[model samples]
Structures are given as C-alpha cells and as structure tokens.
Target: MNELISQAIAQWQLMHSIELVATLLALAYVILALQQSLWCWPAALLSTVLFTHVMWQSALLSDALLQLYYAGMALYGWWRWQQLKQGSAGSRGPVYEWPWQRHCWLIMATAVAGLALGAVMANYTHAEFAYLDAQTTVFSVMATWLVARKLVSNWLYWVVIDAVSIYVYAQKHLYFLTGLFMLYTVIAIAGYFIWRSHYQQQPAVRLSV
Candidate 1:
C-alpha cells in the first residue's frame, strides 16, 4: 500500500510539472500573439506539443487532437507571419477585418463539423463531455486560423473560447490550466481592442484588401 501511494505521488508530481511548463508557454504564446509578434508561433508550437501528451494522459482525446492541430497551426502561422513581414506575394499585409458574411458562413460550417465530430466520439469513445469538447476544438481551430491571418476578430472569438475552456479544464481538475484559460479570456478581450486599434491605423491600400 505504501509503494502504491508512492507511485501515485510520483505520477502526480510528473503531471503537475508538465502542466505547469505547458501553461507558462501557452501564456507566453498569447501575450506575444496579442503583441502581433512572430515569436508567438514558436511559443505556441512548444506549448501545444507538451499539451498533446498532457491531454492524452488525461483522457481528453479531442483536446489532445486539438493540441496536435495547434502544433501544425503554429508552424503555418509562423510562415504566414514571416511572409507578411517580408511583404511577400499572396501575403495579406498586417491586421485586417473580414466581412461579417464570411464569418457567418465559417461559423455555420464549423458548428456542423463540431456536431458530427461529437457524435462520432460519443458513439465510439469513452470520452468526457464529447460534444462540448468537439465544439471547443472546432471553434478553436477556426480561431487559430483567424489569428494566423491577422484578423482583428480572432481575439473576440478567443474571449468566448477561452471562457468556455476554463470550465473544460476545471472539469478535468487541471487547476493551473483553468487559471491559464481565465487569463487567456482577459488577454483576448484586451487583444480585440488592441488589434482593432492596429487595424484602424493600417494604410488605406491595405484596408481595401
């Protein structure tokens, strides 16, 4: 019994260390993202890589998959941001706003995709909050893409996503991650206003894009 308890304590310590490291990296990613710094992608890449393992260990399969996707997006976002910085061909310069109609269509498509993913996970896996997990994963994918594109509205999407994520992480007893998401919610709210200010300052030529 003592040996079993010792093993459990060691396991808990390991998990706690991993979660703490990932949480700090994720926090850095968000702060850099809000600043529109290229370094954010590298931070995100590292955080998601750690989180993929952490979420899998926690039995949050969809969340694990989302972290994998985030890892990929981190690479893409880095390249995309670099292109923008260099004023390369096909790069949309700086912060820009997308049409409301586009966002409406995007929301509908992702919502349907989330429901479908949730149904599959519910029927096939012993996943917790399958529907909710799928919804957050799908929307987060979209929001991450919007961030890569430098869309001003992505922060608004994150505000909602991060708020929901607090509940999700809390349910899993990931207190540190829940607190991180809480911070994410506040940062996202600030990011929206800050990005909007940047958008308003962009050159008229870029605004027409």
Candidate 2:
C-alpha cells in the first residue's frame, strides 16, 4: 500500500502546471454549478481551454476534442443561464426532469455515436481506449447540455461518465486527472440529491410559469 501510494504521488507530481490549474478550475466549476451558481460558466470555459491543450499534449484526441466542445458550450450555457435568471426575476431556473423515453433515446444515440467514433479512431489514429473515450465524450456533451438547461437528471449522467473517466485517465497514467474524476463522481452524486430536493421545494407556480 505504501508503494502504491508513492507511485501515485510520483505520477501526480509529474503532471503539467496547466493540468493542475485546469483541475482546480474544474472543481470550482462543479461546486458552483451544483449550487446553481451562474459563475460556473466562466470557470468551466477557462478550465476547458486548459484541459483541451493538456489532453492534446497527452495524445487523447477524443478528450481534447470534447474539451473544445465544452469551451463552446460554456458560452452557450452562460448566455442561457443569464436569460433564465432575467426571465425569472434574477433567480436560478427551475430544475427539470426529462421523460424516461427521451433519456432512452439519448442513450441509444450516444452508444451509436461512440461506436462510430471508436471505429474511426481505431482505424485511423493512435488514440488509446478509443471506445471508452468516445463513450465519455458523447455522453459528457449530452450531460453538459442537460446541465445548461437545469435538468435534474444531468448529475445522474455525470455520475456514470465521471466513473468511467477515472479508469480512462488511470489507464493513461494520469494520476491527477484520475483523482479529479473520482472527486467528480462524488460531487455528481451529491449534486443529484441536492438538485432533487431543491426541485421538490420549488413552487408549482414557478414550474408552470
């Protein structure tokens, strides 16, 4: 156990400065987002930019591309949240729940897309863990959109994505990133219960409006 701890520490110590910065920013974003704070968008944007560069350097092309998508989504999420705040008298928007049927469709779509991306990357690129990378990337995009829309189920999706991401990063010897995702999994679980409770307490009038 001591030897394993030492190895993990050494790997973490070797992480790039930008990766550390990104991780910190990402943690901040998740915490704020869980609390339904609008400030999370800016933090997410900065973190995604740094993470994009870090993933590219690490040869995780799918993850790098996902980060680029996240950068763009950050802007959209910011604007959308601002609109929600203004429309609702400066309060965070109501949390929403999608129908089970819609989620089933989304899951099917993500799986198909992941398989296609995995096949392309396996055939044409040196990307490692292509299927797993694609799975996380595709689902993460969906989850981010759900978060932007204030969906209560977004945390559920993130729980699965973050858990898988921990393994992916660990396989690449990115101990810092692996640890970050592990924390993300816990945060995602907490976010789910927190949002659910808030949703339950929300005025029916507000939801109808």
Q: Pick the candidate with the highest TM-score.
A: 1
TM-score for each candidate, following the candidate numbering: 0.95, 0.89
In model 1, the clashing pairs are: none
Which one is best on lDDT?
A: 1
Q: Give the C-alpha lDDT of model 1.
A: 0.90
CA lDDT of every candidate = 0.90, 0.88
Candidate 2, residues 35-148: lDDT per residue as tens digits? 899899999999999899789877898999999999999999899888877877437877777678888998999899999998987889989898889889889988999998
Clash tally, candidates in order: 0, 0
* Per-model RMSD to reference: 2.4, 5.2
Per-residue lDDT value at 109 in model 2: 94
Candidate 1 displacement at residue 13 in angstroms: 0.9
The C-alpha local distance difference test score for the whole of candidate 2 amounts to 0.88
